[model samples]
Target: MPESVGMILTLIMNIALFSTANYLAVKLSTRNVKRRIIAGVVFLLFTPVIFFSTLYLGFTWDDTGWGAGIMTVIYTGLYLLNGLILLLSAIHIYFKK
Candidate 1:
C-alpha cells in the first residue's frame, strides 16, 4: 500500500477513536461518580495502549515514509488529548455537588 493511503487510513481511525471517546465522555458525564471514575480509569489505561499500538504500526509498516510517521505522531497525540479530556471530566464529576 502507498504511504499516502496508509496515512489517510490512520487519520480516519484517529478521528473515529477520538469521536468515540468524546461521545462516551459526554454520555458518562451525567452518570454517577462511580461510573465516571471507572470511565476515567479506562481512558487513562488507553493512553499506554495507544502508545504501544502506534509503535507497533510504525514498526510494521514496510516503508520509512514521513507521512506515516507524522500520522502516527498525530494519532498518539490525539489519544493523549482524549485521555486528558476524560480525566478532567471525571474530576469535575467527582467535585460536583
Candidate 2:
C-alpha cells in the first residue's frame, strides 16, 4: 500500500478506536460523573490528534506556527472533535459539579 493510503488507514483506525474508547468510558462512568468521563475521553483523544495534525499536516502560523500545510484536514478535525469530547468529560470528572 502507498504511504498516503497507510496514513489514511491509520487515521481511520485512530478514529474508530477513540470513538469506541470514549463510548466505553462514558458508559462506565458514574451517573453523577458522566460529564467528567466525557471530558477525560475528549482530552485523551485530543492530545494525539492535535499532535499528529501538526506532524502530518505540518501546520504553520507565520512565525508562531499555529496552522499551516495541513494534508488531512478532515481527519484532523475528527481528532480535534474527539479531543473536545474528552475535555468535557474531564471537566465533569474534576469539578464534580
Candidate 3:
C-alpha cells in the first residue's frame, strides 16, 4: 500500500476511536455543560490532527511538486485550525469554567 493509503487507514482508525471514546464519555458523564464543552474540545482536537497528518503523508509520498504544494497548503490550514481549537479549548476550560 502507498503512504497515502496507510495514512488514510490511520485517519479512519482515529475517527473510529474518537467516535467510540466520545460516545462512551458522553454516556458516562452527568450531562453538565462542562462535560459537553470538554467533549466538543476533544472532537475538535482529534479532527484536525487527522486531517493534517493525512495531508502530510500524502504530500511526502507524492511525486508531483504541484500535488505536494497543494497538500502543503491543506496541511497548513489544518495545522492552524488545530492550534485555534487548542487555544479556544484552553480558554473555555479555564476562564469560561
Best by lDDT: 1
Error of 3 at 80 (Å): 13
Model 3, 1-97: lDDT tens per residue?
Answer: 7857755664565456545764664564433555655655665666666566655655566656455456546554544464455445555556654
List per-prediction Cα lDDT, in the order shown. 0.68, 0.55, 0.55
Better of 1 and 2 by lDDT: 1
Cα RMSD (angstroms) for every candidate in the order listed? 2.5, 7.0, 6.2
Model 1 scores worst on lDDT over the 10 consecutive residues at 59-68
* Cα lDDT of model 2 by residue, 8-94, tens digit: 565566567657766765666655455555556656556565566545533222232333324345545655666566556567566
Candidate No. with top TM-score: 1
Give the per-residue lDDT digits (tens) of candidate 1, residues 4-59: 56555666766787788868866866657766666667777787777666656655
lDDT ranking, best first: 1, 3, 2
TM-score each candidate: 0.72, 0.45, 0.41
TM-score: the better of candidates 1 and 2: 1
Instruction: For model 1, name the residue pairs that clash.
Output: none
Error of 2 at 38 (Å): 8.6
lDDT of 2 at 24: 66
Model 2 regions more than 4 Å off? 34-97
